[model samples]
Target: MDVQLRQLRAFVAVVDEGTFTDAAILLGVSQAAVSRSVAALETTLGTRLLDRSNQRVTLTGAGGRIVTRARRVLDEVDRLERIAQEARPELRVGYAYAALGKHTRHLMKAWAVAHPAVPLMFVQSNTPTAGLSEGIADIAVIRRTLADERFDMASVGCEARYAAVDTEHPLARRRSVRLEQLTRYTVAIDKRSGTTTPELWPATMRPQTRTVDGVDEWLTVIAGGQAIGVTAEATANQNPRPGVAYRLVTDAPRIDVRLAWWRDDPPPCLDTLLAMIRELYSAAPPGLPRQRVPMVVPPRARGRH
Candidate 1:
């Protein structure tokens, strides 16, 4: 049947208000218009929806069933409209691991104050490029270099490295551990999305590698003493596992924090986001050991394979 959203709204309003006159007042239209809308809805559904022989209008048996369904339809239409309105001019940023690490709250609050007109959303995905490659995000916070030449990236900050081990593991007793010390244990790595790789270690001293899919799995395996995990300081800050202890990886290379977007159609606020993130990292507490660095990818090197 050709039922319109307006007709459903009118039907719901009439039922809620208990009279066509009241519904017309709520809808800001004449009583005749409200009556006509309800009539059209009943005609389209091919059913008697209301009995209006007396001053008090009442629903027929079919009207009760149809009103319930019509109200749901109208409510859903209202929700759809609201979603469209709210999503317009909104920004969705994706991340696979620690989202800005310790600076997440500061970044969000600052963004809200700086761009009150735009809504910022953080979407989490476990894929290598967060959700960027899947078209689920406008930009992504990535820890590793994106292999795709279609993307342009900027390094906003760098985080120190940490080694995650079980609380009961011998290495956990130490305040910090060297990369070579971790080589003695099996290393749990999320090869697809993680920044750590066997190449981080000297070829002869490479630890036996165990594959993991995501941060949760890596933590679980590490906590169970199945393997040790090497990750950026952000992961340790964001995920403090009860059974897992994170020790500084004193000898490992720092992890670069990069913001990436599709080069051909970069978001308008890309530059602003990068600048704000750089500021947040730069202003971070010195104890966190955050390093503020200029964009590592040169203008000439951007968008290049």
Candidate 2:
């Protein structure tokens, strides 16, 4: 059976308004149009929906059962319309965790100066796509690879990796830490959206991992000293918790920060956004490699030396 959304809307509207005249007024359609819509709906459903008696409209057994479902359907249709409306002018950039970190404000200010009418907003969604796939955002800041062919991605920048350790942890005293040094401790990782993974280290050297769903949980676990966390510099810059010290992961590869959008339906101002990001990254990028402190040997190795 062909079920039209308008027909469902008309049916629900009639039920809500008590009279066909009121329903027509609410829908901004003529009473005749409202009557015809309701008639067509009943005809399509192959059942009498309403009892029109004494200029009053009341529900039949079938109508009573169907009215609730029709309201639900109309509600869903309204939601779908809202979703379509969201794709208009404003740009919503979603991120699974900490957005551009220290650069977030800079980018916002730059975008505002460039495109004052179209607002640039950041939304946090702890999903792999950030929120692109879920329709919660028009663009996404994805740290890891999003293998979906449905979306196109641009490599905007890269962030250095940082080790999150409790202040009391011995490694926290160091200016920087290495992957090998962290191997002895359990690492907290958000497998879905986090940039770090066990694969960063060789199979033999990989640390025991504790899985977390989001950044808050990861930080809590690290602050509690249950596990150490290795994350993008963005996390360190934005999320500094008490008792949690962030140290640069000197030898680990940097996390590639990328912007992703639907391949078929990229957002407006995308080029401007990309250009601003490139300029920001190019102007004041991550620290130079030469600045990295040499890895300090652990106490065990230092004792032998």
Candidate 3:
């Protein structure tokens, strides 16, 4: 009954940043404010939240559950407020090449017909650079990859991986391929620094690695018979060069088209964007995956429970 937005905000900050001091810095508030907010939140919920000792803070069992729900609620509230302030305008969405797959044409056509009045702004983004980290997209249809925690994400769908080689290449005849098998060939990937590569590639197949600037450039190398490459079905669809083809890599994670917001509290322009994105992703054909951590196991306990 006495719950407050500040309490929720404070708790989420600590859970994400891992320290009262860090949360306070991010909120531009005193550490005391953070500690007080968390304490008050625990009292209101009738649960002990943190176990702090040894100068290291840890979340209790209940803290994990509470923080998860609090993040969702706070995020929605933020988005709602922004939506209220800004009159509906055309939604702008940012995405890398792989996010908009072969079916993008179909999706756009249907979206236009359904919400023609709402202008749709789509920008093609190449490479996963500071643009996404700095909050450049409302919904970023990125490659089959897990976005960093810094971004609010909604999975579009999985992008199946394909192996592209010259027509006369030995492995071209096979319906599928693996990373281990491609070790001998030259490999190309959109190297996303700071993100986990193993999560993207489940199978252990290492090829001579190379990074390309854009999809077209990547296609050129593939078409020239200079290198073998792995790409999502969407990338293959978007850049259909004559000499290249992609098939199941066996190890590719299901790529997802995610709706992202810089902060949990999104801007109003973001709401329309999110709404439109949600509508699009909801009806998306199978193969896209959203984030689902099986169980958020908190760090080891330190202070009293």
- Candidate 2's C-alpha runs over 4 A off are 1-88, 287-305
Cα lDDT tens digits, model 2, 1-305, are 88888788778888888898999899999989888888999899999999988577899999999998888887887899899987556899999888888889999998889889899999999999999999999999989989999999999888899898887788877888888999999999999899998999998899999999899999999999899999988888788788788888899998888999999999998998998987787788674222223354767888673
Clashes of 2: 0
Can you tell me which runs of candidate 1 are displaced by over 4 Å?
1-86, 285-305
Scored by lDDT, the top model is: 2
Provide TM-scores for the models.
Answer: 0.68, 0.68, 0.53
Q: What are the lDDT figures for the candidates, one per model?
A: 0.86, 0.88, 0.66
- lDDT: worst 10-residue window of model 1: 286-295
lDDT of 1 by residue, 228-261 (tens): 9999888888888778888888888888899999
Which pairs in model 2 have colliding backbones? none
Off by over 4 Å in 3: 1-88, 129-137, 144-150, 193-205, 264-305
